[model samples]
Target: MNGTICQSINQSINQSINQSINQSINQSINQSINQSINQSLSLLQVMEQV
Candidate 1:
């Protein structure tokens, strides 16, 4: 009855929260990886020029 409805709503909220957290974490990891790779490439180009 009312208890079941409340439980359902809570579950939905928790799911959305979990999804948002996962997405942010994934984006952060990807950005760091891209930055590191770009840095290494730039370093290599500089070394070549020298």
Candidate 2:
């Protein structure tokens, strides 16, 4: 009984940690992608004007 309880507690902790990590990773990835896309778009516009 004690072992099962400990296992469940560990599982919950691991799940929460994984969730937070994934969220942060996804957020940063999205931000970088947006930045790169915006930069490229601006560059294209400048090229067109030139």
Candidate 3:
């Protein structure tokens, strides 16, 4: 019984770690997308000036 409890606790910790990693990855992706959008907008503004 104690072993089962330990196993469950370990699984929970692993899941939490995985979730944190996934969240960081998503955040990085979102940041890159925003950066790309900003770059595109800047290019459009420059083209309009010409």
Candidate 4:
């Protein structure tokens, strides 16, 4: 009975860790995309000026 409870707790902790990691990765990907978009826009503006 105790072992089962421990196992359940471990599973819950693992799931939380996995979710946090996934969220972090998604945020980084979003930031990268935003940076790329901003850079592209700046380049376009420069081209228009020329």
Candidate 5:
């Protein structure tokens, strides 16, 4: 019984840690994609102007 309790606690802690890591990674990936899209759009606009 005691061992099961410890395992459950460990699982929850691991889950939370994984969730936070995933969130940060997702945020960074999204930011980079947005930046890339914006840069591409700007470049296209400038090319058109030329």
Candidate 6:
């Protein structure tokens, strides 16, 4: 029926939106973690040089 088709389409759209949101959140989290880790590592190296 038309209602079932619409429901399925809506479900798929919601699923895709959730997936993309999760992916972006994960990417940003990882990027920030990497940035902080690199900063700390460089700081350690500088401390050792000093």
> In order, what lDDT does every prediction score?
1.00, 1.00, 1.00, 1.00, 1.00, 1.00
- Candidate 3 residue lDDT tens string, 1-50: 99999999999999999999999999999999999999999999999999
Q: Please give each candidate's TM-score.
A: 0.80, 0.86, 0.85, 0.79, 0.93, 0.85
Write down the TM-score for model 5: 0.93
Off-target runs (Cα >4 Å) in candidate 3 are: none
Model 4, range 1-50, lDDT digits (tens) per residue? Answer: 99999999999999999999999999999999999999999999999999
Worst lDDT run of 10 residues, candidate 6, spans 1-10
**Off by more than 4 A, model 4:** none
> Number of clashing residue pairs in every model?
0, 0, 0, 0, 0, 0
RMSD of 3: 1.0
Native-vs-model 1 lDDT? Answer: 1.00
* Candidate 6 structure quality by residue, lDDT tens digits, 1-50: 99999999999999999999999999999999999999999999999999
lDDT of 3: 1.00
Q: Which clashing pairs does model 3 show?
A: none
In TM-score terms, candidate 6 sits at 0.85
Candidate topping TM-score: 5
Tens-digit lDDT track for model 2 on 1-50? 99999999999999999999999999999999999999999999999999
In model 1, the Cα lDDT at residue 30 comes to: 100
Off by over 4 Å in 1: none
On the 0 to 100 scale, the lDDT of residue 11 in model 2 is 100
